[model samples]
Every structure is written in structure tokens, then in C-alpha cells.
Target: MASREAPSPASRGVSANKPLPPTFKSIQDVLNGEGVAKGTLVSVIGVVRDLRRPIPTRNSGGSNHGRGPARRADQSSLTANIDWKCVMTLCDKSIDDENTAQNGATGIELHLFCPQNAMPEVGFRDVVLIKSAKVQDYRFGTSLLSNYRTAIYVYSASAIPMPPKSAKDALKPRPGSKASHVEDDEHEYVSWMYHSMNKDSLPEADVFEEQANRSLNVRDKFSLLKDVGDGGFYDLIVEVIKDPYDLLDKATVWVTDYTENKHFYHHSWDISNAESGRDGDPYGYTTAFENPTTKGWPGPYGKQCLQLTCYEPHASPLRSQVRAGGYIRLRNLQIKYGRNGGNLEGYLREDRAYPSRLGFDVIQKSEFTEDADSRLKDLLKRKLEYKKKLKQQKEAFAGLENTKAVGAKRKDNGESATKPNAKQRRKIQRAQRDQEVQKEKTQKAESLGLNKQVRCESEDQPVSSFDRILNGVSWRRTRENGEEEHLALPFTNIKFRANVRVVDFRPRRLEDFAAGRKMSEYDCLEDYDGGSASGSDGQSETLDSFAGPKTWEWRFALELEDASPKAKGEKPERIWALVDNIEAQQLVNLDAVDLQANQEQLSQLREQLFKLWGNLEECKRHEYDAHLESIRRTKLHMPPPDSSDNEIEENGPEQAGRRPPDKVSNKPFTCCLQQYGLEISEADPTKCDSGEGKRYQRVFKIFGTAVR
Candidate 1:
């Protein structure tokens, strides 16, 4: 048996107010004693993995797995390979969750046994709880702690002495019951006690070096205590230090800047009120990190890390197969640091789990090596590029913001700028387009009869009246199903006429307007007071001489007032704002002549293209047009071929009708017709009726336009 020996806080680089208990003690007498025997309480830290007891798989309207029938199966399967050893490893994990462990048939009863003289004197058995990390497969639970192994420790008892009775039982003769001790009487009893309490012999520094390796073997950070004499390292098992810091979890790993030391001990190793030999350290051992020359080692700086242990279940009463949800693996583990008892402060070294048991190859790898400056430079460059991209995005967003704000201001200044307050107008126009898109998405989804419920989000923006005012558009409100007010064209006044003759003309009916006019008819250009036609005459006009556009004398006479006017002797500003659901007066009426004229220009222009592209956009736009014109010109420039002249010679006399309405070749006609869907007839001898040929003529008429 071993007894704990720890230096006082003053000796260690810490200020521990409470005395640390011994780390090791014997459990023999307690096993036989009548009183409550204290078992070492292990500090188990990990995420919670659900306890599963495998039941028959029952299909509940999910996916079908097995072949044969569409019928359901028993879906109550415990999907995971549980490690039964972990369950058996603990002597008894207290029933923290009564509902989960006590009555639940699925949850297990934990079994635990600890080193007697542990940090808490003797760990509290009833209060202890062991949780397995959910994802124990190749990740968190199993992989995270795979390289690690548990270390059992033994020491003589002092405060709570053993009963001294169980020791005599092993030597007792079997009462008609077969009994043969594993070893000699006293020695066998003590040895058996140790064996029963712990499975393997205590680990040593040099022995650990021989055994521990990265790939072949792993060292458990939880192994035995380390010595201190080797430059505050090799005295007794461990040294106690006081710091409020605590926990080595992912979120806390990078709490502070990384230190030079790698391998570190946990704070739980501290034994309150413990004392050892004159060396003062509870225990001591050398890590594989010893330097050949100085016997001291250096560690990585700023490389933060933590011990993340995940437990896997080999077999559980609940989970016999593997499941994705069976275990949850923790990520981003780090050592905690800071004023609040952080995990970083408790560690003596990191990297190798059990630094004391390090081997040769591991030590070689553990030694600090030259940093690849080039890689670091590359990393820095990548980080910089990422930051630059983020900044560019932010700047673009800012530009958009400014544009939006400028547009709003421009819209508000309705009568000032002749630019049509286009920015605000476009913004409002986009809202309509957005609404259309949302409607289409919804309708398509509904048509498919699938539940793709998407909410149409209307922009929460201030409405702008730019289109209604400067664009000279009108609105008529009709109550549709008495729910929404629909705005249509024709007239409805939001701003009452009070000298509303600022417009060119005002007409009540659509037919009352004349031809070739947009809003000119609705505008009132004649001045009521000044008998001037209010029309722009050929003569130059001065501001004072002109009394603005004539006023519309409405039946409802209202005093006119300017909402906002420029300072005296300054140009008046334009203003615009959006009204949500109000009837508006329309200026332009829809007409076929206007639509036809607009379409004609577009149709004619469609036949044209600029061979000299001004920019990337124009190059894309004019590519086809340019190609057609070039082909026609090339054909015209070609010399007449002798073979093709046979057609004219066979005709004998020149026949006017034989021209065949400027007939084009079948190949060219087919190409043109196929491309533009135009059909050519032989009726007219000089012209083609198919709109495409006419457009091709127009393209030829224009220098920069296409021919085909």
C-alpha cells in the first residue's frame, strides 16, 4: 500500500488555502470493516452518451430496410457497440438521475473503484457520476481517449485505517468449501487485495519510456503521479499548485496564449492534507522529454490543447449495434485559462498524455522542431486574403447603402432633377419584380402539390411616389374582395388639384386625348389668369416671364400651398414619396398606336447591331448581327462564277417575272428561316413579306447592323 506525500502550497507555485489530501491508500481493512468503507472517487469528465438497451427493431413509417414486405419491423433497436468494460470498470456510479438509472430499464448501474488517498481524501462514492461521450466510434469517445489508459494507484491508509480483518480471510481454511489463496498467507492477502483493487503494476518513468509510443501504444494522462526532483519534476508523484482556473474542454482550450510547456498534470491530482518524504512532492518520475545535453526540455508555445476523452461501449444491454446518434463527439477541445479556476493552470505539461511514461521515439517527436516559415507565411497570406474578401463585401454593402440613401433623397426632390428620380423608381420597380418572383415560387410549389411553404417578404421600406409623380403615372384604387386596394391606371387624385396645372395637361377621359401624345393631353398648359397658352413657344423664355404651367380650374377650389420650396431667389426642388393604397390620377392611357410605334422601333433596331463593340456588354449584344452583315457583304464582293452563269444563258430572253421576288437561294433561305422562323414566298418579285427578311434589309440599310 502507498501513502500520499504532497508539498505545502507555499513550495509549489500556488496559493492553495485548503490542505490537499493524500493520493494513495489501502482498501483491505475497509472491505472487511463494519463501518462505511470509503472508495476512491474518480473525476470523470466527458459528454453524456445515452444509455440504450437493444430492443427489437420496429418500423414506424420510416424507410424500409429489409426485403420482403412493406409491413413494419421492430424499430426499437439500440444502435451502437457499447463497451461493457466501461460499465463494469466503475465500482458504482451513483444514480444521479433517479428516473434515468433507478427505474429506467435501459440505463445502467455504474461500477467504480478509485485510488484510496485521492484528491478528495476518499472520493465520494454516492455523489459520483460517470458519463460516456456520445460519439465513441472512430471519433470523440473511443478515438479521443484511445491512446489513453487508466492508472490505478495504491497507498497505506492513515485517517481511516483498514479493519485488519479481511487480511485474515484469505488465509482462512475453506469451511468445507474449496479454498486456495493465489499467494502465500500475508503476502498473498496483500497482493490479492492490490490485484483485486488494481489490474496492472504501477507505471515507472523508464518503464513507461520502453512501453509508450504514439502508434503502437498510448499513455494515459490519468496514469500515476510524477516526481519533482528532476528540476522541480522528479521528487514524489506530483506537485500541487493553486489557481482558480479549471476544466480542459473545447470551448476553454484557447483561453490564454499557449505556454512553452506541453505535457501537464491535472489539478484533481492534488491530495489535500497530504505529505510525502523530505522531498515534499507526493510522487515523481521523468518524462521521455529529457534533453541529451541539459536533461531539460522546451515546449511548443501558443499551441493550445486539452484532453478530450470519449468512452465507447463494446456491448450494452440496450445498444448492440452502431448508431449515428448513439454517441456525440465533442470538437474544438482546449485547455481553459484565466482568473476563473481554468484547466490550463492545473496542467503541468501537455502533448504526451502521460509525460512520465514517454518512450524514445515519442520524445524525439515531442522535441521542438524548426517551424516551416514558408508554411506560416502562406497561412498568413490566406488569412489576409480572407480578410480582404470580407472587407470588400462590406464595402460593397456600404456602397449599396449609400446608393439606396441617395436614391431616397433624389426621389424626395421630385421637381428638381430631370433625371426621373430613376434610382428610387428602380428600387420600387424591384419590389414588384420581387413580389412576382415570390408569387411564382409559391405557385409552382403549390402546383407540384408539395409543402414548400415560403413566405413572401415585402421590403419594409418607405414608399416612394417617383413613378407616380415624376414618371407621370396615375393610379385608380379598386377594393378587391374588400381586402386589398388594387392600384390601376386612369385617374384618382392623392394630392388634390390646387393649382395642379403644374402638369402639361389634364384630361378626364381616355378618348378625350389626341394622337401621338403621352401625358401632354392630361397636362394643362394654358394659363387661366394670363391668357398665355402656357406652351413653350420658339422664343426664349425667362423664369419670371413664365407663370409656370397653367392651372387646372377644378370644380373643387382649394388653396394651393407648397410643401417644400427652395430658398427665395433659388431653384425650387422636386419632392416625391410613396402612398400605400391611394387612388391616383392617370396621365397616359394605353393605346395600340403607341404600342405599335414602340414595337416598330424595337423591331427595326433588333435588325441592327454595332460591329464595333464599345464594351463587353456590346460585344455580346452585336456578335450575331455583325456575323450576318459580314456574310452578305462577302457574297456581294465575290466575282461571278462561270458554272453558275448557265442559268442566265439557258433562259435566252430576259424575263421580268423570272426574278422570283428577289428570290434567295434555298440554303440561305433555309438558314435564315431556321434561325428566325421566317417563311419567304415567290409572289412579290422585288420584296419579301416575312418580317425577318425585311429586318435584314433594314440591317443592311444601317451600317452597324446585322444582315441575317
Candidate 2:
């Protein structure tokens, strides 16, 4: 929704308050016996930012109200305004060091440094909130320990709730009404949160906790932060607003009892700002917005913001690129979350060599079934190929062999009796064997379909892709079974790393279609980024820019980081990345055993489909047989009677009378039913019939609709 508040009409604007520079602060820095009054309310807005000497008493500035600069140096803390009443309440009331741990809004609040007169003399529920905040210069020793605490400030104001109003409208005190204290509209409650710490009592222990091995979801991941510390390590979250004037001084409150909010993150609270950070309250600190909406999540774990205090160089960027490293680590990282859920966890491992293709086999163990039929099909294929080659060789030498045998017999001139008998028997036996083999081949071919004559009688049989592979060259490999096996592995036969280069390609048109689409190729060249994904596992990266296939240099050899490599002095890299094919890459990640399982599963699926097709063919064959048998019997039974003719004769006449004339014949008919061998029905020479239905529908069932 668009904001309801209009822009400020004032031509001249006050220079917003200056932010405190980075410096150590003590507890005494937030406390003052000087600004205290009985029942004085304070609202929390901005953080009680850094500790620095005040900005030289505001440069002795003129008020722009026609007055010159004041002589005395004014000492004040910085303050920002807030919209929610709940934040004001928390900041105003929770400044006491004891209350800091219990306050709902963690370290994010607005702070003001002003005197008692800031509140109008009602000691009231709603008063004018403090317009400015003063930051105190924090130095070491006694004050340093005190500054370790989190503080809030509140402005005193009368809150007579009538209805929820705009942040702009809510700033104005309702005129003439002494107070707004409607019981239903006013809600105040608080809850306590206890932060657990490590055995060392310091807040810097194992922050990246893997709940049963680092949680795969955001909620589960963040839950580990609680164990970081038990002491007063505050996670201060600052929500940003564009201009500070938009939120300057409003009355707000906070109850000791907190109403639970579902959206709290790492002690960050979402309370109404009017009550929690309003002026008259005692405890709120000030933090300023560097940008319009200084939106940020806690970095790493338990880190509310980048601790400029810990940073050696204040100007360093959040991200950097390094040429070569064992593992590039992010000490602290905050991931964004959306309305529904977090980003899905998906892992991609690419081959450094080839980019276009991948090798894959499904690894659903329970879903796999043994493929007995595919094995059988392959067996049959081998047999057919062997028989074909044998026949070809036999024809090539057929006549020559007979001539030589006959000539030898003649040369022997009435050869030995035993020889003649042996020759005759051998010829007969050879012929008989050939006939038997041919018969078997014919039967096998016939069994392949729903009908007979699957193989052509006069034409040629077309060789399929499957048949070509079976008859052509094949590669074999030795498996773990101590037996030779057939394998179609692309990497085993073809070049991998040297012949290929992995390039992450994205479609250019995708960005045009989607404005927010990420529009660049991601670097997916393997080297596992040198195990950069999961830290160093003794794995170093090998950077090899390949020239051609199988020509990788020995100097850049990658070896196992953990286990010693086959070659010494080689960098350790993921072999999974060396693979060029996608499926092969996945198989490598899953390991060799998984690869076999996947192939087996695919083979099983192939077998199941083959079996199903076989069963369907058998069923269809039986159906055709039954259909043919009926016609044959009808023709055989009566020299004149055909079974297909009788049923149609009666049904055809009835349907034909109602349907429109046929387009071809110009005669109304529902069908022109014809039988292959059966005699035509005598009643209606032209067969036509429609199924039973209402008159209009059944009338034109053959051509379906007769709209006219």
C-alpha cells in the first residue's frame, strides 16, 4: 500500500542529527541522574549508536528562527522518530540494565538526550516527545564496562486510543480530550527470552550448528544461534526509515509482559513503534539510516549487523573474488527468506570437459524391477546376427564346395562304399538341419505381434536402431563381478576433460520475459571450485584449460586431497568434475556403485515395457484368431450363410431410414459396414447401422452431427 502521509510542506528543513562515530561506550553513558523526573516516559526509536564526542556543539549554529548561534555548548544524545507505539513503550520503559534482557525489541531503538522540560506538565499518559538525541563520548576503564549494556529511551505522552491512525496523524495530540485510555485499544504485555551461552561463557563458540548435521531449512538453521552465548551479547537489529523527520517524537509504551509475535527473528521484535520508542520513556538508543531502507538480516549467526567495531577496514565490501584458494569461506552470511519458504536446496555438479550433455540413470532403489525380458530380447538379437553371418558365408562358397567334393569322388573312380554312404547321409542331414532352423526363425518372427506375418513375405525387413547396435561394433569392460561386461559409457571410449569445456549457458530471451530474472552465465566449470562448496577436504583444485580431447597436461594433474593421489605433487580436485557427460557427472558424485544400480534399473524398465508389449501382442493375436475363426466357421457351415451378414441386415435398415443420405451415395445411412470375407447381408445390400440412442442423436451417428 502507498503511504498515507503527505510530504512535508516546509521549505526549510533542519539538518538531521549527526550520528556518533565508532567508540567504546560504558553503562554510565546511557544513564543520567540529570534527565530524570518522576514518571517521565521515554520512547525508543533509533539505537544509542556509537560513542564519540558531540559534533563540536552543533557548529554554533543559528536557529534559522532569526536568532544567532547560542553561546553555551549543548550536550544531547541523538534521537529518531518511530511509527509503532509498542516500540516506543519498550524503549521508554526498558532502559534499566536489568530490563534490557527482557525487552521485546532487542537493541534496535531510537534514543534522545533531552531534559525534564521535554514533557508537558501532565506527568501524563501522552506528552510531547523529545525531538533530539545526544550521543555521549564513551572512553575506557569504568565507563567501558557500563557501555556494554543495551539501553532504551521513551518520551512521555498521553495515549487515549480511539482508533488506529496514520503515523503522521497519530503524532498530533487529539485536541480537547484530556487523555485517550480506552481499555480495549490499549494493550500492554511482555515476555522474557533467555539466551544460552557456551561453556566458555563467551558468545563466540560453535555458531554454525548443524542440527543433526547442519539443518537443510532456514528455521532449523537459525535455531542453532541460541547456543552462541549466555552473557550480555546483544543482537541489535535496526529497521530503516528514509527521512528521520517522518518519525520524529511520538508517545509510545511497552508492557513488562510481551504478547508473542510469530515473526521475531534472532531477538528482533515487531512491536508498534508509537508506544515502544516514544519520547517520554526512559530507555531507547539511537541508530541512523545510511540509506532509504537500510534493510539487512543478521549476518552469519547471532550477528545483527556487520560489527564496524570488529572491522579492521571500514570500507571493505561484502563480497570478494579470489584466484585460487583451498576453500573460500564466509565467516558470517545472512540469507533472505520469502513469504512462503526459503530457496530450494539443489546441488549441481558439472563436468569441466563437456557442457552440452550428461549421463544419468534413475536411482530409485525400491522402484526398480528386474528386466528379464530385455535380457531375453538381447539374447535373441545375438542369435539372429550369428545365423545371418553363417548363411552369408555359406552362400559365398556354396557351389565351389559341391564341385570339389564331386570331383574328388570321380577321381576316386567308384570310391570306397563307406565313403559314398557317408556323403549321401551328410547331404540329407545338412538339408534337414537348414529346414529346421528356418522354421524356428519363422515362428520367432510370427510371435512378435497381434497378427501373423509380422515379417514380410516378399519385401525386406527394416533394421532398427537397436538391431544396428547389436550387429555393429560393441565395447566391453570388466566389472567387479570378475567377468567381462558390455558398457555404453561415453567417457570410457571418448575424450573427457581435454576434449571438453564446461560453460554455464543461459537463454538470453529469459530475461526479456522476466524483469527480475538473473541474467548471466554462472561459472559451473568443475574443479568443485576446489571443494569450495563444503570447505577443504584435503582437496586442492587443478586449473586446466583443455586444448583437445585426451591431451591434458601432467603438470596440472588433479589428485585426491585426502587419500594420496597416484601422482605426487598434483593438486587435489573432484574427479566428478572431470567427467564431461551430465549423467556421468551425477554418477560420479553418487559413486560407481550407484551408477551400476541406475543402469540396472533402466534395464529393468526396458524389460518391463518389452514384457507388456509382448503380452499385448499375444492378446491381440488371440482376438484376431477368434474373429477369423468365427468367419471361417460361418463360411464352412453354410455354403450360403455368413454370420457377419445376418446381424447387420436387421439393424442397418432401421438406422438408415432415420439418418441423412450418405454424401457419396446420396442415400441416408448411418454406416457402410463392410466385412473382409463374409457375405453381404441380403436385406440391405449396402450395410449401414447406428448404435441405439435418442432419435435425433442416433439418426446421424455415423458422421456424428447433422446440424442442418
Candidate 3:
């Protein structure tokens, strides 16, 4: 009838009456419900696949008892809340034998709620041993949750923790910490079991090593990239189409597979529906790497064009070495799908060794090389043919312009006796000026050695810079038609400047400009195929034949107003302008990479434009009084010293009595139309003929804007 005493620790299998530590569990075992008892602690080891930025919790109203407004207090408390929590994804090959550690099925997400101070201890690809962590079912699946007693031990590459000399050594309590007793005991148990099970092998010890060792070849064709899972290292031989551009600390390069000579041409002649021609190429075929559903769609393969991202130490030097149109071989590059799920992007992987941290070899093609791959020769031949076709297209366009100019002159002579109105007369004079300007430019180009017959091989040739071809050519005009013929002024020669308020920006979506239905980022390169090019208004226009460069330019509706208005009643006039890459870069102080990658940069651009022109109400109140005052002060400067002055003039007699310098206008904004040798006649500012039946209307193309 007496109560039985509990068994002593020694009787249960201990020599000195000590408690045993919790059993170590593999991630697979934990996920399979091996240790699902409530409040049970389990140990697991894995490589950190992803670590999200720590997100600080919002401060509750309880702390604002003596503060001012809740919103104001919230704003002030933004940095005070240092308690941050983040979710991390960890993976180990043991979880799933069929899955690769990278983008593999063996990964599990863990939620770690901790103070912001603890964040820097862990990073991507770090091997970690998590101890005493509680297992819980999460929205994503089974996940580990770090409780108050959970301990995370991160292993540094240089000093990975080796198994203790003995189980007793690992279990011994440390001197400085009270928590070490439990942690040390648990660590010893896990290490003992791990070594006992695998005979000296540690879990996830080779996780980081596996990625660097496995190198995929360019011939793999991105076939190895199947899921939205783990990323891997790859080697590629690609041509640099877009050079490395910076975005914050990282640099990006756009490349294409040069060895794959698959001729997937999207031609204008193959378009099935002329009505929907402006929408997209109907008969175009998609590449094998893209979505299977879009097999016949008009778009480039995601594989054909891969974006390389270089970070930290690799970015600066890699950006300098890569150049557009150059063939380069990249090795040990990291490949991962972007967040947008469109294409597989590559990045330069930092190597542990010195001297060769990143691999990038610029391949200089040589006709004399005896062992060159046949594919390389074919690539060169294709490039030459493409360039030749581009040259022919340019010459044909120029010749067409010449014929239109002659026809315009004959028409003007026949209609001279009709007694044209002021607007009509202005149009006729503008036409005459444009004709002369075109003829002069044609002759000038020839004189400058822009050979009409062959491809312009020299970079110094005016034709080599495709700005004019991509955008539009410039022309001169007379402000007043009947004014002295000698008074005709040339348009502004520098990048076009304009004093205009941004009335509206088109295409609110970034994809509309870069990955639209009808066009890719470089669709303008294919404009030489003939037929009417798509215009900003979604209409076809033969006159404005060249569809502007894709992604390089943004269409904006601008309100062209005098920076310094002459009258209080003056109103702004609306015009359209195509802002090309260079000007957009200057205006927003951002490159295309940043603009496309970050949506916030687009908002920043709009804010910048608003700051320049001011909002609608602010712009309306802007007056020219200050500008007038500046002009007055400029004109009142004292005349040059007379001969009586002691200082000797260079040509004393002739220069002694020279007048003051000419007074310059204090205009609020520079006129881009004037800078580019172009203008809209005052008689009819709505539209003007840009030669060859092409009437450039309300659209005012601005290349740059003055800083406010």
C-alpha cells in the first residue's frame, strides 16, 4: 500500500545523475511529424537559402500617453521601434533526395522574431544549427518558430565549429553565461547523435560548397532552370547588348546567347491582321525557353536575353570591362529568376580566392583563328548581314526625303499665285527652309565622309551615331516669314531644351514601355521593315515612320509655356515630346535599370518634374517680373574703358572705346525646339510639316530640361 519512489537518473542510464538533452531531428523528420508533441524542443541544421529584410513592428498607442498627436508621435517613433522580425528560408539536401539543394523541395521557411540587433548575425547561404526551436504549422507549410529559449548558432566560413573533443566537453557549462548550461547540453547531444548516425559527417556542412562546385554550361539553354526554387551557378558565352548600368550599389548587364543561331525572325510582312498590326506581331514565334502557351507569340525568348547583376566588389570592375556589342564569356555566374517571374537572370558570384574573384572574358573575334567554333563564324556572318540591312534602310529613307523635297518645291511654284493667307504663307516658308536645310545636311554628311553606298564603319561619322535615325533629324526655320532672308536662324544645336509643365505622362505601367504586347525594349531596331510605324496615339503613321526606341524614351504631353510670360492673361499651349534615354537620365538622374527595376524611381521622376515646373496652381502664378529685372540689369552695364584709361587694350586704338557686351535674355526655361533647330510656327503652333508629308503636330520632342 506504499507509494513507489521515482527512479534515480543513474538507474535510467546516467552515471552522475544528469538529465538528458532533447533528441536531434532532421528537417525531414520534423516535417513528417516525428516530434509534434506540444512544447517539445527539437534541433535542426540547414543552409540559409533566403533571409528577408527585417521588418520593424508598428508602435502601439500604449506608449503615447504623454505624447502629442497620435500620427505625429507615430512619425517620431518610427526609428524607436527596434524590435524587428523576419522570415528565413533554410534548405538541406537530406530533406528531399530527388531535389537539388538550390531551388529544391527540401527547403522550409522559419519565422524569427527578434530585436533588430540580432539581424546581422545571419545571411544567405550561411550554414546554421538551430537549437531548441519549436515546430508549428504555418500558412506556407510546416515551419520552425524561434521561442525565447531557442538558440541560433551561425558558422563562419573561416571558423566552422568542429565536434567537441568528447560529449562531456561539449556538455560542460561555460563560465560567463547562465543559458550556456542548457545550450551546451543540447549541442553536445545533437553533435553526438549526428556523428554517431553518419560516422563523423555533419549535416549541411557542404551546402554552400555544392553550389560553387556545380557549374552549368551555356549549352544547357536554361533547361536546368525549371522551377521558382533554388538558384545555381552557371557559365555562359553571350554577347553584351546593353552594357553594365548602375542601380544603387549593384550593376546590371544585358546579354544574349551568341552561339545559338536559331533564326527566329518577326517580320512585318508576316503580320496577319493589319488592323491589329499596331497591337503586336500576329505571326511571330516565341522561343523554346518561354511559356509554352506563347509558342507562336511575337516576343523574344527570356533565355536569349539574360540580365547579369553584379554586386559589391564585382560591380565596379565588371561594369568597366563589359561593352555593348562585345562577345564575353562569363563563368561561375549565379542564375536566379527575378521576383517578376519573367526571365532567368544571372549575377557575378564572388569567389573566396584572390586574383580571380569573378570570371568575364571578352572574346575578340579573329578570322585567322584555326580552332574557332563554326557557330562563332555564323554569328559574325549574321551580325554583318544585319548591319548591311540597316545601312540600306538608312540610304533608302534619305533618298525618299530628297524626292519629297523636290516635289514640295514644284508644288510651291505652281501655287504661288493663289494669294495665301498668313498661316499658309508661314507653312510655305517653313517648307522652303526645311528643303534647303535637308539639302545642306545631305551635302554636309557626304563631305563628312558618310559614304552613301557602304556601311559607315567609322565611329566619328555622323551617320554612325543613330540618335537622328532613332529620334528624328533637325531643321532650321524663320521666326517671321517676310523678314530679311539673312535673318533666318538655325535651330538650337545642343540637346533640345524646353520650358514646359508636365501636363501628363503616358503609360502608367512600366511593362507598357518595356514589355508591352506589341513591342520589346528594342523594337525600334526593327522599324526598318517598312509599313506605317506605330505612333504614340495608337495610330499608324507613315510620315513619322520610325517608331521611337523601345524603353529608351517615354512619351509625355507637355504644356509649353513661356517661362517669363509677357502678359498676365497668357495661357500655356499643349505639345507632345519624346524623351529619349539620355534626356530621361538627365531629367530623373536615374538609369533605365533603376527605372525598370524600382517602381519608386518612377514616382521620384514624376516628383522631380513637378518640382521643375511646379504644380498647376504654382505654375499659373509664375510671373516674368524677376526675369525682366535681370535683363534690365544686364543691359545697364558700363561701357568699355576709353583711351584715357591707364590700362592698355590689346589693340589700344580700336578696342579702347568698345561698347558693353550684348544683353542676354533671362528666359526662365531654355527652348528645346530652338536648340534642336526646329520650331512650330506662331501662326499655327498646333502642327508643322517635318518634310515628306509627315506633319509633326502638337508633339514637341524635348531631349532635356533645365534644372529648376
C-alpha RMSD of each candidate structure in angstroms: 31.7, 33.5, 21.9
Best by lDDT: 3
Q: Candidate 2: lDDT over CA atoms?
A: 0.23
Cα-based TM-score, every candidate: 0.17, 0.16, 0.31
Clashes of each: 105, 118, 10
User: Stretches of candidate 3 above 4 Å error?
Assistant: 1-25, 29-182, 195-556, 561-585, 588-616, 619-667, 674-698
Candidate number with the higher TM-score (2 or 3): 3
Estimate every model's Cα lDDT from 0 to 1: 0.24, 0.23, 0.44
Q: Order the candidates by lDDT, highest first — what do you get?
A: 3, 1, 2
- Among these predicted structures, which one has the highest TM-score? 3
Candidate 1 segments whose C-alpha is farther than 4 A from its true place: 2-398, 411-708
Which runs of model 2 end up more than 4 angstroms from their true locations? 1-92, 95-467, 472-708
lDDT for residue 590 in candidate 1, whole number 0-100: 19
The residue-level lDDT of candidate 3 at 65 comes to: 17
